[model samples]
Target: MTIRMIGRHIREGLKNMWRNGWMSFASVSAVAITLLILGAAMVVALNAEQLSTYVTGELEINVYLNQQVTDAQGQQVAREIDQLSGVKSVQYISKEEGFKRLKKMVGTQYASFMESVNSGNTLPVQLVVKAANPRETTKVAAEILSVPSVHNIQDGENVLGKLFSFLNAVRDVGLAFVIALIITAMFLISNTIRLAIFSRRREIEIMKLVGATNWFIRWPFVWEGILIGVLGAAIPFAIIAYGYQFLYHYSGGAFVALSFPLMKAGLVAHKIGGILFGIGIIIGLWGGIMSVRRFLRI
Candidate 1:
């Protein structure tokens, strides 16, 4: 289309909104409310996903070397574990350092007494192993156990298994819930826009009868739909961005003294905002085209 035609279509689209004032308000309101609900759900779901990641990241496997293994053998074992597919990193800690850590953890009151009786340090030299992902931890731990220098693995196998299952279940539920909401938003937004266009059936029919092509009949309404969607999303996007930032600060980065920390508001708010705007535009465009297709029979 020429620039003049594009400008005309835009001019007509804006004019249509005023011509159908009540219908336009209804369409805009419906889009705003639906996107608000969807945006709120997204916030909750994203935070849950972040929490799941944080908790799982804290889980690591501690590999204790056998007493017969030398310092050189321990280093070799660490290197071997680092070479494993699922392994993220491996750090070797000497028995002397481990003993110091024990002292520090046990507190100064008991440190002197423990030192007085400490003729020998029985703490084994160990490797601290981290998995690339929480789901891969079991495989990584199993591979670590295969090393001949490893005497034992302390990964809380049973607890870790249960934790993984629970986290996975929560993630699946969150994902399904978000998807359902999105589908509902699309349906409701389209239906609302459909109502707005249905009122203009006579205008559409006259245009068609006057030799206007389907594209020409549709462009004005499409622009109007896009505008409605963009306007509706503006408030919710702003609210979510500022609200999440306030919540993040009020909670001091984590949730009420909990170990799980939220994703940085500055980092994720703009990203979420962009996602919200994109989704709004897409849903608006879809509602526009679909309503035009069904109601105007174009």
Candidate 2:
């Protein structure tokens, strides 16, 4: 299309919006609401995964040695653990060290009780294995238990397994919700455009009578719809970004640490912004096309 024709179509679309003020507002509002919900869902999904990852990273496999094992025998077991696949690091917690840690964790509640129990009898020297992936922890735990002196393994496999499963389920549900919102938004916008074009039947009829090409007539309406969608999305995008910025700066620390699949605020915004913008444009164009198709049929 020529620049002049394109300009004319844009002016007409804007004029249509003003002439059909309530309908235009409704269309933009619907698009805005849909995009906003989808955006929020995506942000939540990202953070959920991050939080899960953080927890996984923090996971430790505790290999408790038989209290009968000598210190030299325990050290040999620790060396074997360090060489195992997926093991990030190995820290040896002597029975004495374990007792001290127990004291800190229990605080004052068990301080007096701890004094009566012999440290060697109460706690066994342990090889704490940190894994690169939480799933690998089970394998590491099994391997540690195979060692002669390592009589028991106490990795929190049951808990991590349940947590990972829950995270996956939540992510799937969030995705479904976002997809549904997108579809609903698309339909709502399409109907609004249909109404907008329906109100301008005479103008389209006149153009059709003049033998104007299909592209010539259709392009403008599509562009107009796309522009409206873009405009609508821009407002909420800014609002969401600003809100995230505020939360990240102030109320975000606790949330950040706990995120399942965590990300910094800046990185999350950068990744999601382009996607939201593209979604806005696509939905707008779709609405415009649907609206114009009916007009062309007549």
Candidate 3:
């Protein structure tokens, strides 16, 4: 289309919106409410997924060596574990350091009890193994147990299994909910645009009766639909951005105590805002084309 043609289409679109003020308001309002629900759900689902990732990354396996293993042997075992397929890193912890950690954990009440353990450190040296992937921790732990001088492995297998299972379930449920909301939003927007078109059926027929092509008659309404979507999306995007920023500022390091750091507000807003705008534009354009096609029968 020429620039003049495109300019005319835009002017006509704006004129129609002004002429049909009540219907335009109704259409824009419907889109705004639908996008608001969608925006909220997206924020929640993204945050939950991030939290799951953070927790999974923290999971580690502890491989305890036999008490008789020398420092040289321990270093060799650490190197061997490091070369394993799923192992991300291996840190060798000596018995002395382990004893001190145990004492610190047990506190002053058990300090004397820990020191009286036969005047010699009974704790075995350990190789702290972090897996490249949390899901492969069990396999990595099993492989480490077969290594020479490795007496035992403590991978928190049971707790980690349950944690991962729960996280997976949460992710699936959140995805399902978001999909349902999107479908509902599309249905609502389509119906609203259809009603708006119905109100202007006569104008469309008059244009068709003239020498105007079907596309010429259709472009204005399509632009109107897109404008409604953009206006609708703008409100929710602003609201969500402001609300997230406020929450992040006032959260007071509470989430840090829970071991799941909240994502930065600016980053979240940028990602989520782009998604919202894209969704709005898609729904608007889709609803416009669908409604016009159904009504015009062209």
Ranked by lDDT from best down, the candidates are 3, 1, 2
Candidate 3 backbone clash number: 0
All candidates in order of TM-score, best leading:
2, 3, 1
The C-alpha stretches of model 2 lying farther than 4 A from their native spots are 70-72, 83-88, 118-121, 132-135, 252-262
Model 1: which residue pairs collide?
A: none
lDDT of 1: 0.77
**lDDT scores in order:** 0.77, 0.77, 0.78
lDDT of 1 by residue, 1-298 (tens): 8999999987877877777777667666766766677677677667767866676878789999997777787788788888889888888898778888888889988977879756677777888898888777878888888888789998856775676688678657766765676566567556656665777778878988999999998898888777777877887788888988999899888878665788888876776778777877887788778877887776
In candidate 3, position 187 carries an lDDT of 61
Give all TM-scores, in the order shown: 0.63, 0.86, 0.72
Whose TM-score is higher: candidate 2's or candidate 3's?
2
Question: On a 0 to 100 scale, what is the lDDT of residue 9 in model 3?
Answer: 81
Residue-level lDDT for 195 in candidate 2: 72
Candidate 2 C-alpha lDDT tens digits along 1-298: 5789878888877876777678778778877877787778777777767766677778898888888776678788788888888788999987777878888988888788877774335567888888867768888777767877778888987987787788789778877887787777777767767776777778778888999777776776787688778977887788778777777777544574444334677877786788788889998888888877765564
Angstrom error at residue 92, model 3:
3.0
- lDDT by residue for model 3 (1-298), tens: 9999888987876776777777767666766776777777677666766766776788788888998987788888899889989899998898788888888888998777877882687778888899998878889899999988999988887875686688678667766765675565566556655665677788878887887898998897787778777887898899898998888888952375575777788887888888888878887788778777876676
Instruction: Give the best candidate by TM-score.
Output: 2
